[model samples]
Target: MIENNNLVERQYEAKNNDLAEEQHEIKKNNFVVDTEERENAIEPILGSELEGLDPSNYPLITPSIELTIKNRFSSWKIAKYYLKEYGRQKGFATKRYRVEFHRNRTVKKRTLTCEKAGKYKPNKTKPIGQQRNKGSKRTDCKCHVNLSSSEHTHYVHITFIYPEHNHTINADNKRFTTAFKHFDKSIMAEIEHAVVYGYCDIHMIRNLLQLKFSDQLFLMQDLSNAIQKIKCDKKVNRSDASHLLKFLLNQQKKEPTIFVQPLINVDSNRLCSIFWMTANQILLWSHYFDVVLHDNISRTNKYNFPLSLFILVDSEGKSRLGAQAFLNNETQESYKWVLQQTLDATSSEPNVFITDMDPAMNAACKNIYENTYYLYCIWHLLQNLPKRLKSKLALIEKYPNTYEYLHNTLYPTQQSWACVFVNRIFTVGMQSTQCIESINALIYKEVSSSLSMINVVEAIDSRMQKEALKCKFYNMEI
Candidate 1:
């Protein structure tokens, strides 16, 4: 009973794991209907082509297999023709049998009886009177008599029948496709524009925009046909056809890793993800992400920073993904939409956030999540410091003792060796955003830049998904 209970618990756990939520910071993530969902939603596919022979109208025919063969031909060669009993294979070595012959001629029937191979004593050294060797031997007619090869043809017969009436129900693609295809045409057109602009190009864009079924993701075969139709495109070569469709995809990207900068505030600024991404995790992060969407986004979200990004790790630890943002210098564009999308793509709680000591981002964090901690990257701070002090960094580097004194021994201390860089030379706290620029360059490695707006989104979406799967498994949902 305990064993059974454990098995049931394990099964339940597996079921729950399979139900992993599709909580998207929209990763632009999509959903796929499961079997149970489809079945419960009113349509179940039961294929019955021949009328009147449907399973509901007619009893389901189940074929039976029998392994017992009696009074049969003795020719071992013909034994192969009589029947077969299948028991399983490999581990079980199981074999199953099917009846192969039915002869009309009268045949002898026999029973199998066992005979003892060894003798046994009744008592100590002597056999009991009259019961000397009881059950030692028994007579049975179970026998095999080989027929001459010449008579073989006269004794053996075999029959074969058409396999009929085996069936199972599956999801009805036809019905589902019909419903899917008939979705709002306007949405379809938009998706096509997005999908095509993502996967293909602008030339075919106009024509695809006019398509009625633009809102639906076509069946695999139908999608193939649609691409084939593009053979006539004058501006797009057959080779480049795939590129036209690969809108959001960076052709060169192995994958991408996105850097993040969560909102931080005195109330909530430590931004859980940032503080969690400690200095020890440098190896955990490297170059594996990208940047796209050529638009000037303004840094405006009160609770989140512009291009608040995340990271992904593939099954093979060797390959990583990094994400970066597009900026026309300091002003970020469409920030609210971007932040929302990033949130959809990443976890509500983030893992790492590498950003400048920007107050706007700090305020955003305090607004969205009131309990997270944000760690300022030491690297980003180094880069930003040069803007404040002219020759202070040079002096700090020249006066190594002062630099060490200020940065290491006396951070907040006004008088220290590192004072040239920290206190004497520049202004800004100990926390930094040093590697933020380098990290951004690394992420761009995988994000598509040459592609159109639509294609870039698609590629980013695809890459992000593969990466996000890894994150989900690791519980790095943010």
Candidate 2:
């Protein structure tokens, strides 16, 4: 009997050996005929020959075959092929179920499932290589947690300048006090608050200064009217205003690491600020001086250096150093004693005192330490010399003989005469105390908020960090 089972019409020849030995193949998913007259090959339609016929689908499978007595392949081969094809068709459903299981599973359950799923002995053809590094989102790694730019940012230099001439500042205690007491107090308190918080927003302070002291940012209409307006402004509450002012005024009232000095040098043409690697520059250990007189005292005429000392990092980016007040009466002996005690108390004594050739400072350092070295502050000496000689300091460059002699003498060691004149000069024009003036200006502008001695010390510490960053960048450029 001849049979035609494929989508392509083909006749299978089972016998007829006298004419020619003939064979036909149906198991290669293709039809092959070697019949009495010819050998021909035909590829069958993909998935077209199915045992269970479906109008919409076909079977795609192949096997090496020899027809059995019943004219069929083994049932075991058919079953195995069906199982593989069925698993492939339901992949989406199986994947959905697996994801649900993983989500609901406990640690123990997940471990068991992961182990079981991975247990298959993969085909030798399966690839093997290192697994790719997992991304943080999928694997829940800690690398992304709390990432902030602040960690990398060096210290910032923040400065607040107070309005120098505000009329509302002074109060006539003996007068009627007719103006709204709350308004006056509020204005004053706001000014004090800006100094502490490093910001301001009072209207009257702005107008009175003729410059913006927190400017229109405040609720008040003008510096004079700020007294009346603060009462109506909801932001300025009476209870909180008093407390806030008090808190800011008492800035940096923390317990300081104590330093006791046996031989202290208080009288410097500039400041005597120490640079500590670990601790902050303790400006309280040194007195500060500034451009203006304090209004806190009743005497309106007395001239006093605000002593707004600042401790800030220099432009070099090292730790902050305490800045000194501007020129004033040489520092007091009691102050000297205290400073010496403080320096001695630190990790190591700051032995070299840098300052201009002011008699008081020179005498103070000489008396304080026998072995400690004192270098004449180059800047201070340069500044004072020109004033004494009544001509510009640059003239030294123009006049080579005295200028070269003076410049060469200013050496680090005492072995040469150049070291002697530069070290111990005879004229006022050659003596310069330049560094302290710059340091003093910084203290007033960037560090000191008010004339309060306590606040001055705090400002010094705060300002040093910023100044150091500046110094570091400047040096890097150089």
lDDT of each: 0.33, 0.32
Best by lDDT: 1
Worst 10 residues of 1 by lDDT: 85-94
Separately for all candidates shown, the number of backbone clashes (residues 3 or more apart, or on different chains) is 92, 48
lDDT of 2 by residue, 260-304 (tens): 111214574332322121233444223211111101111111123
Q: Mind giving the per-residue lDDT tens digits that candidate 1 earns over 35-120?
A: 23443354321222212342222221123333322222333223332222111100011112222232553322212111111234
If scored against the real structure, what TM-score would every candidate get? 0.26, 0.30
Candidate 2 overall lDDT versus native = 0.32
Q: Residue 68's C-alpha lDDT in candidate 2?
A: 18
Regions more than 4 Å wrong, model 1? 1-308, 312-347, 392-451, 462-478
